[model samples]
Target: MEDLVLNWDLGTGGLLLLAVAAVAVLLVLIMAFKVHAFLALMVTSIGTALAAGIPPNRLVEALGFGFNPTLGNVMLLVALGAMLGRMIEASGGAHVLSERMIQLFGERRAGLALSVASLLMGFPIFFDAGLVVMMPIIYAVARRVGGSFLSIALPSAVAFSAMHIFSPPHPGPVAASATVGADVGLVLVTGLVFALIIWGTVAPVASRLIGARIDVPVPDILGDEDEKTGFESRPKVSTIILLLLLPLVLILLNTALNTVASTTSDPDAFKATPWVAILRALGETPIALLITVFASMFVLGWGAGKSGTLVEKIADSALGPICSVVLVTGAGGMFGGVLRATGIGDAVAESLNGIGLPVIVAAFLISQIVRLAQGSATVALTTAASLMAGVVAAGDYNQMQVVALVMAMSAGSVGFSHVNDSGFWLVSRFFGMSMKQTLGSWTLIQGAMAIVGFVLSLILWAVASAL
Candidate 1:
């Protein structure tokens, strides 16, 4: 079912109170007790709904109703994404790509190589995957570069965040786009613009300043053993580029072709072109991804002399984590659906309808408030998206304006990534940072990224309206 936002009977005063209560509980859990975001979100959502006097039996029924459909839509995509990412990693694609990137940048620019891997891998894979698989290489590079972990880690983190927030194939942007009816192509374009701001400008510069203060260890568990898988020093750069660029090129072509058709009236005339239509179908994300997977099987596996079993192993490896995340997110969505069914979403949305801030400003403020309190970016994103779904849908939202609305929601997601956020402690544990240091570095960088996201999205909205 679509995540529709129906109207509610919640009074403005009641909503304000509920909003405050939701914010307070989430913050208390994340910051005070340091709870896992997934748990924290479930806790706060149920807690707030109850506090709002949602009937317990009704709420439970709503939740039960929401489970399957919410999870079903995303379950396959997450699994498929995980499957694709695993094959890329296990096939020694990471090793091959890293070798080539380092060679291109030269040994002196090892930091840059680590940063680039984070960016490129991030495009097609999830953040945790990027972290788990690439961190070892990052550690090796840091040691070779003679820089502190922060130097390499900072750039790598920056790149990962950029891709996580900006790139498709990652569930966040994909779901956000699907939720709001934004064109995938437009979202991609907008996401790319925002990512550049973060990675190209904000992340690299922030790393230089922030990296100076922290020194993370490459955890022994995450460290690479010296067993030479007899992996080649480098795969052909041409082969690597072709594999890497495959999905991006396909997705972009899909977007570009759609964009081209929209700008003119002769749609079928354009579509009638055999070469264009053929490339369009072949270059679609799903087909193109399958192509890349096959390419990796041969290029990185056989080309690099890995056993055939290793190829099978790659596909099997993605299941555990992908299943966990997809299920959890599906549970979260079901939880959201219950909130909507129980009238909590509408109550929350209606309560905020008249706040003095501009719509965008209010969205950011609510997101930041919720984020600081809860520390689950996904929760923040989903919650904000659910609430705003009503507002943006009610208004005449052009395709592009949806980006601003979504970014405002995303801005909320990044606020206060302290104890509640898994990423916060992941950084703290690896970097050996005190809580205070995580706040200084990880917390600050995330907040910085979130704020910048909002500011730029606002700029885009204004420009769009004026046009």
Candidate 2:
């Protein structure tokens, strides 16, 4: 989180061009030269940093500092979530859940059912973790229902991305709301409304339209070709649901209590209570996931009649496949970090600061630019909010207007996820999608979500301004 302390003498125009060139080179390296994504990202990061005038001594430190933080944030979640997912997959729990869903919703409506489930689950879990845990079930449903994987996967993926970008307890929106001094409750409520509306309406239509063009066969997660043994003794549906919901319920409780405590007259009194402190600690994301993983060991593994040794092997096996995912995601973060070190995001936002545009529109546009430049939505949102905060504070705005602007910034933060973005790789690798397929499907989904969310926010801002 420490800002790179180098002096950047480039103007906004110069830095913006540099950002474009960096991304173009990255694409060429990956798409044309066939460089491994990890090496390409590292090369681009170092080259970009040097091009942007980063001192040589600070170069390695800058890249490591950027790479390490992202790696730290993601590694535990990916590893633990993967273990939990593997347990569910190996024990026939995912098959059970998918079967039940297909029966209730019917094969034709399976995609809708999965998406709704993902929306509910996405409220609490981070996008990558939620997607990882849900993948087995998604795969099972796709196998049973017999259709393009995109028909099922895109809707569910959009749901997670929508919730993660817009809602609180997911860090990005929470931090942006705080920076802009918007009411957290208002932002949370507004975000949920807009996100759900878009997820229900825009995302499905977009998914169907795009899914047809991208033909991705489901990858072999459950070893479908040789899985008769595990499927013979499937776990109960109720147990599978409980295992999935446990962490979500705990995390939601933590968010609710913290919101209440923050709003109360004596915040410290709530924090000082032994039970509150303990629950908060337990509900911290890694702990919540850990608790869920342990519980899953019982509910989805041993209780399902698998041996402890088998469970250990399943969890251990999960780590091997995702090692590449973790490193490439970290390198993606490193690229973003190098861009940040060169002060590109700040320069663009600063240049956009005073152009007499509507505050909400400005927020969306600035956030979108920063997002395209850097590839981390959280960084884009927080940096844009910081740049725009003074203006929002000084303007004559009503409560809902403030909320709408926060939503606008949140929406813009999700703009156009591409090669430089880590989430791009996460989706591409997990779903067995190629780069062109990822662009046509995942990238386009993000663009649709961002634009639709922004449009909704614009309407809200206009209505609130009128009032």
Candidate 3:
């Protein structure tokens, strides 16, 4: 992959202030002080704008320019994702699947269900989105079958995390594939296989066994504060299953069609066929997502007999996580932009090169520092990846190795999530575990996940070198 060079001449001190200040302060406020990410993001962005020394009217312009586009582009997708998740939850789809899976796993083998759901859910949806959608199912199963939330929810989250960090179709690895000039389809296949293997070999099944001795504190994934008199009427198992798989099918089909089209030898034959053109159109990612969303609506609404009001309510419920994610992403984006603008990226690159550390190692370390200091995984991933993009542009590296590099960054981010990481608090708050218990379980879990992920990446790296 080609290294990215920052365009420094276009950036200025004021612009730098508006961008980095927002990112750094927002992260500090949330992770260090335990401030809510939503409020911290808003205030820090505003502070950044104000610090840039822009005129009041121009500051308003910057705010509008940055905020609206960020919200519109990212948040809309996030909203759709949230609604889909809620439908899966409230429509009884989640309950039915979890219930059935529990029976299949039996008490002796329930942790395996976490691995299964986590692997499937990671294909198209965000990790947190999968967690939000699947957590309730974990909790309900826990309450009904009798086990700590740790037994189910932790494994489920870990499974999803494996998919998120290691798998493709999730943003970082997907973007890394493009940045490194890899074939996307190959990465997708490879990532899924590795994700499933890691989740199986690494996830602590013994959490259930050891949990019996430890009195493992349970965390809630669904903010289901409501008391249930009886189980809500669930949508059919088939409908729930179909809706969940719909997005992935479209994406994979699109990828397959495009590969076939790319290999077409005859120009006349390629352009002449109406069927070929139609297949090309159908395979696009945005279109695939759109098709999945509309399909899910019908399956959950009409097929499942859910009312529009219920769907709307579930959508609103989905907003909390979506909003929290966007604010952090925007702040992170601004930070990346500023690092480029300020010439800090270039200086850092030169310094690393002088010290004889490879660019990938530098990128990995920078991201790790950010993650350790501030606990927002999204922020750590975005800013660090974007900054590393500069280094990626600076040197020629193997396309597949870039994927390995992304895994290193992801591994660095996962371990040692403490007071500063919002996920730490979210898990703590929802599950009602003390900070100590959270450190013991959530902290240990994250650290273990990262360690195992890094080791896997090293193995792949060695194999790539040998090849």
Which candidate gets the maximum lDDT versus the true structure? Answer: 2
Candidate 1 Cα lDDT to native = 0.62
- How many clashes in each candidate? 3, 0, 11
**Model 2 agreement with the true structure over 339-410: per-residue lDDT tens digits:** 887788888888787787878889999999899988899989998899888998888888899889889999
Could you tell me the lDDT of residue 275 within candidate 1? 82
Per-residue accuracy of model 1 over 1-467 as CA lDDT, tens digit each: 23423244456456556655665675577578987545765676677556656666555655555456646645544455555555554444445655665777986577776777668766755464445445545655565556566767777887877777765655666676677666777777777778767777666666678877666664433323343434333545576557666666776676578558756789778877898798778655556666666776687776667777765665666666455455545554544444445444434444555565677776777666555543446655666666667777888877767877777666666665664354554455445565666778888888788878888878988977776
Q: Which stretches of candidate 2 lie over 4 Å from their true place?
A: 1-8, 221-225, 228-232
Best by TM-score: 2
Please give the range of 10 consecutive residues that has the lowest summed lDDT in model 3: 1-10
Q: What is the alpha-carbon lDDT of model 3 when measured against the actual structure?
A: 0.58
Error of 1 at 270 (Å): 8.2
Kindly report which residue pairs in candidate 2 clash with one another: none
How high is the CA lDDT of each candidate model? 0.62, 0.85, 0.58
lDDT (C-alpha) at residue 157 in model 1: 81
Q: Looking at model 1, which ten-residue stretch has the lowest summed lDDT?
A: 220-229
Query: Runs in model 1 with CA error above 4 Å?
Result: 1-92, 106-109, 113-195, 205-234, 264-288, 302-308, 321-353, 358-443, 453-467
**Which residue pairs clash in candidate 1?**
26-373, 27-373, 216-431
